[model samples]
Target: MIDIVYILNQIDGVLYFPILIIVMAVAGLYFTLKTRGVQIRLFVESLRILFEPSGDESSVSSLQAMLVSTASRVGTGNIIGVSTAICLGGPGAVFWMWLMCIIGASSAFIESTLAQIFKRMDNDGNFYGGPAYYIEQGLKKPKIAALFCICLIATYALGFNLLCSYNLQSTFMDYSFYNPATTPMIIGAILAIITGYCLLGGGKRIIKVTNTIVPLMGVSYVIVSLIVILVNYYNIPAMFALIFQNAFDFQSIFAGFAGSCIVYGIKRGLFSNEAGVGSAPNASASATVSHPAKQGLVQTLSVYIDTLLLCTATALMCLSTGVARNAAVSGAPYVQSAIGSVFGTAGPIFITVAMVLFAFTTLLGNLYYVDNALIYLNRKNKPSKRFMNIFYVAAAFIVFIGAIIPMDAAWAMADITMGLMTLINLPACVSLGRIAVDCLKDYEKQKKEGKDPIFDATDIDIDTKMLDTWY
Candidate 1:
């Protein structure tokens, strides 16, 4: 009768506290220095390339790829996750979240740039890659690559998707019509059926669905947040002051650093933006950009959009209302109540709708990464139609199971799996950091020459034999 969830939580605590945080911070700083702050220097360039055409109608465009990744990054974590951080760690957590995004964007650039550099083109002329691709191709370690793929599948397809489903369903707990016993199953079934339909259609369908829904939902959510913020305009300045003051409270930092604002902020920030967690690169590699660094830069922009824009909107909307931050008012309920206080009954309704949209798109985006990892694990042999059908059914079944699980268990599972992914990806990125830096230099060198940058594998010192698409 060992409590597995408790053990998972304990392990997650140990992995994240000093170990993952230190490693992630160091990797982010290292990449920032190596690339001379590509995330900042190429900020405008990132926006410029985002709308660049794919050159082929069938290929994924840079904007499409970004939406795919952003779909996953801006899910329940943006709402429920932000609320939880502030509830437990105080408003100061918001400051740490922003700080993490600034540094973590560099790590995002390196991993995504490396993904594009070592990407593989399938027989159908589609591109695919991620940490597993670079780990095997760049580091020349098949075993490690396999390990990373397994972790990626577990994190996204199983753990995170489950949490998304649970969080989405939890939003309904405040409704009068919701029956605790039957409602979860009903909601889960509906979600699973919709998700299965998209998954069965394959990656293109998922891409199309996310590409359309992500933008609409993102803009709508932000508009609502803005309305809430403007309604409480008078409290905005004090909210900012509280966030900064708590962010730098040295006494709290030294007294109980483990439970301090910094830990929760960084943890929630990583979950929200997924900067260095190695997830976004799967989407980054899908884009048909002229230079690998172009897609890299776009993914860096995605990190900013997720944390700086979406997460900030949620944080400000919740805090500016002066909602009570306590264990009793954390997660989805906290968000619903925070917005509810402002808009009355309409507030909770809007939050529920927003959560459904965010979490649904997140489910699709997370599974898209799972598809890429499966491709890598299958050794580039496209999974047979029969196998894919079975896979889709299994994925849908997991969504259903996620709905009935306890919230704490679901979050714990996701955090542990995601932490493992970061641990595996960051080290590999550090080891292969040189290639990404060289690619950036080559890109900048071309930009300075007044030439549109196009990547040539031979332009750098990496083994061209490993680059399937960039030859």
Candidate 2:
């Protein structure tokens, strides 16, 4: 297992770079053009959904759905992840991060919209869909799509689920910043019990918890970052210069201008937000909205919030501090030290808190996604609920194991898995791209003509019966 993990890490480290850039750049450009710049058109409308009450009883409020994703999206990767990028890639990495978000927004919109288009109704009539559903429905390859779905469920539930608990426990124990011990059993037990209780209640319980955590953590992170930026206001121009200079000026730096910056920036950016990757679609598919395009719009806004808003703040904070560029510290410790330089011992403490909250939410969100995938795999109107519960409990144990082992290794494993999933999903999206656009255009026309933009399952261009069916 160790050797395999090491091998996977090496492959992931090399393969993921160019792939990230191509996907983000292409998907961003494609979606932007396809939707006729819906990102701009719905910019205000996206914000409006947050303020307005949800009328749909079956789907979560758009805000709640976003929060479910943000729960995972805003994790330690935003802070420590950003710090690591700038440290290795140089300050210029921030530019690529921002660039991806700008383009990745459209990619987010398209995939999520597709998820909505093929969303399945559970026995309870609740909406459930994601890569698996869309893959089966959109691609007409149930066996291939089922493989991806199982991979997703296994990756999340058996792999990352317990890894999160491990991260949380290690983070809390190491908050002292000196001595830390493995407490996997303790951590696993707590998470397992809590997750079991929540999973039994279904998606709403998971979303409810995520809704509360995501906003609180997001606001706090922003506030902390704002303080760091304000204190080092004078460094702002220099930081900006570093980012642009590194992004394109590779010949100028030790790492070369575009070389490391472009590589690491895109790598970290994709890791942080997962915009073009298919994971976000899982969360987006469940959103109850009158139009598939509405859910797409909502999820698109999330890409902005994750990378542009939350991630950019973390990057700026590290660059502004100057410590991130130092050769000495490295990785999460470097980020903690940078924050400490500004806020003293309290900075690390604050970061640990942020990481705990972010990672915790993300863990829950990912688990929720995996659970849905399992349902798709089982296909029967009535899945064996008990098996799903057992699988999640085991996942929590794995999360605990991942926490103390090594953050970088776990991240690498995650990157590899994520890349594989995206490879399958991106092509699927492009093949079904016209259908997504058609759905969007149809929805828009309906709204303009003073009609509700509801889609009958029968109207889906994709053949539902041809795809994988559980029952």
Candidate 3:
């Protein structure tokens, strides 16, 4: 197992340098150009949509959808992920991360728009959508769509749930100085119970829980980061210079640890916001909104908050205290060190609370991802509740085992799975680009003519029958 993980890590190191970086960044760049800065133009309108009370109470509120997206986005990537990027990529990696977020906003807009456009309502009148639905319904390719759903479920079940739960559990254990041997079992049991309850309640329940949690956690962490930044205000300039120098200075990257740093930074950034990896659209699809473009606008703003706001805050906090520059800086310890510099012994305690919340949100989000994919695979709610129970138990078991593995090994597996998921979705976005553009155009024309830009299921040619069943 260790050897396999080592090999995967080596592969990730080699591939992310140019491959993942170029693919994600270029996709974002292309989408941004294609949309002509639609992300920025629609930002305020999306916020309005998010805050307004929804007419349909059975479906998820817009705020709930945003939180679900946030639940997934604001995990390990904000804390350890940022520290890792800065440590390996130097300070400049943050700039690249920011660039990806900027361009990634467009990618989020396009993908989520497509998801909303092609979503299917199950027999139970609940909505479901993702890469699978878009590929099958919009592209007229069910075989490919089914394959995508299968891969996605595997990624969530076999990859994310285990890693996230383990990380959450470990961070807690570390904070309490508990015995590592016994903690995994306790963590696994608690996660199993919590996730089991949420999954049984369906997507609506997940969204409800996430909406309440994401904002509370996000605001608390941001406030804490602000305090750290103010305390270390003097170190901010040097941190910025180091980041800029390492990112553009090709010479620095080639100098032994420099290249690793660049690769690490970009990898974590991609992992953090999940720009083009296509996961956010799964949550975006279930929203009971008028036009696909509306949800798309909402999703683009989500990427900004995740990468630009949350992830950047974590990066600056670490850099300002020189946590990443030290050889001893690693794991959650790096973040604790940065915060501890200001708060003394209380720093690690704050981070422990933050990480637990972060990991908990991520675990809940991952379970939802798996549940939606299962719905797509089954296409009906009456399939087999028993089967889902088995899947959850198995996932919990894996989480226990995963907590015991070395951090690097666990993280490598996650990257490989995430990268593969991104590769599958990017092409679909490019091919279905016109459909998204048409939806946006139609929406704009209606808005201009003093009409609501609501997308009528009958008007669009796809399959109204599939969508009507949802409402």
Candidate 4:
């Protein structure tokens, strides 16, 4: 298990920093320039359209789509993933993480816009599109499209579900009364039961559940962290200073983690926010909207919400309590320790309960994306609802199996699969980014004319008959 983790980390280290990080960073910069920094100029426009009703009666609203992606993005990554970054990379990692999200928002805008542009409607009248859809439609490479579908299912649906399930189990194991031998299986079974029920109900129930739970869970964590921060108000300035100082001088302050500060920081940041990772595009494509750029703008904001707000809150809450300095500390235990210091034993209790809800929601979001991937794989262009049902049950058992593994092994599997996914996905989003830029320009042009922006496939010179949603 240790060897597997080491090898995965080495591969991830190479791809993440020197390769995908640079690729995504350059793509982000290119898109930012092309779109004239739409993430900033249109930040308000993003929020404005969030509540606008999805004119299509069958599909979910834009806000619900955002929440669905957030449901996936805002899980253990915001809490456990942030804590791990701080522990492995030091407080300085926070700075790099925040930078990643801010820049990656542009990349998010690009990919999600492409998702909207290439979206297709099935015979059953449901909308579906993502990196896979765009890869086939724009790049005209069915093989690459199939490759991306396999990667998405492996990473987002299978890999993340297992990794997070292990963490959720680990949190429960921290207590004495829990049977170390049997407890993990028990937790896994319970999660499987709860999640299976929703999976059987189909996509809308999954979206409905996330929309209801994402806001409430996210706000609840923030409210508690705010209370913790308020009590440690004086330490806030010192914490901020430490973050900035160490970000640059981590080598002088912490002996071994010199270069790792930026690498681990960027890695965790990307993992947490998932801005350019192509995961959110699946959920972003699910929304019924007036224009593709509107969903793009909304998704751009989702990155900020994941890293800037939820992730920052977790970091401050951990660092402010002074628990994050311990190198051995990581994952939910770190966040739990920091909050426990302020709120008594309620810390573990709070996070354990929170993890159950947060991780469960993440699993549901994963299954939703998996459903889309399966659809994309269908050669017949017909509903694979029965096959999806079989996969869902198989995944529930996999979750139980994953819960039994050591946390290190779980993370190792997730990182390796996720690395391969980014390698395949970043190129598509980058090559096709110009489409997103043009879409944004068109939307702004219409808005300036005092008209509600509506996307017309014909206007873009793309094949109109291919895109059922736009027509």
Q: Which candidate should be chosen as best, given TM-score against the real structure?
A: 1
Could you arrange the candidates by lDDT from highest to lowest?
A: 1, 4, 3, 2
lDDT, candidate 1, 290-364, per-residue tens: 899898899988999999999999999998988877877778888888888878999999888788878878887
Minimal lDDT window, size 10, model 2: 462-471
| lDDT tens per residue, model 4, 1-471 | 367666765766566657766776787788788889888889999889988998776778889889878777888888888888888778888998988788889888988889988887767776678888888888889899899889888986678888888888878756877897899999888877767776777456665765676678789999999889888888999999989988888556456542466776787888888877788888888788889999999998889999989999999988887764555667877888889888998878988878877887788777777777777788726466787678878888778777888776787677767777777777888788777777888898999999999888777756665565676
Order of all candidates by TM-score, from best down to worst? Answer: 1, 4, 3, 2
Query: Candidate 1 vs candidate 4: which has greater lDDT?
Result: 1
Q: Summing lDDT over every window of 10 consecutive residues in candidate 4, give the lowest-scoring window.
A: 250-259
Q: For this target, which candidate reaches the highest lDDT against the unseen true structure?
A: 1
TM-score of each: 0.95, 0.86, 0.89, 0.92
Relative to the true structure, candidate 3 reaches a TM of: 0.89
Q: Candidate 3 at 270: error in angstroms?
A: 1.9
Pitting candidate 1 against candidate 4, the one with the higher TM-score is 1
Candidate 3 lDDT over 53-161, as tens digits, reads: 5578888766778768867887877887787666655678788788777777888889998888877776667677788878876677888777777777766776776
Clashes of each: 0, 13, 6, 0
Model 2, residue 406: what's the lDDT?
61
Residue 405, candidate 2: alpha-carbon lDDT = 61
Of candidates 4 and 3, the better by TM-score: 4
The CA-based lDDT of model 1 is what?
0.88
Regions of model 4 farther than 4 Å from truth: 178-182, 196-214, 250-259, 380-386, 461-466, 469-471
Q: Which residue segments of model 3 deviate by more than 4 Å?
A: 169-214, 254-261, 324-328, 379-382, 456-471
Candidate lDDT scores, in order, read 0.88, 0.71, 0.75, 0.81
Write down the RMSD of all candidates, one decimal each.
2.1, 4.1, 3.4, 2.8
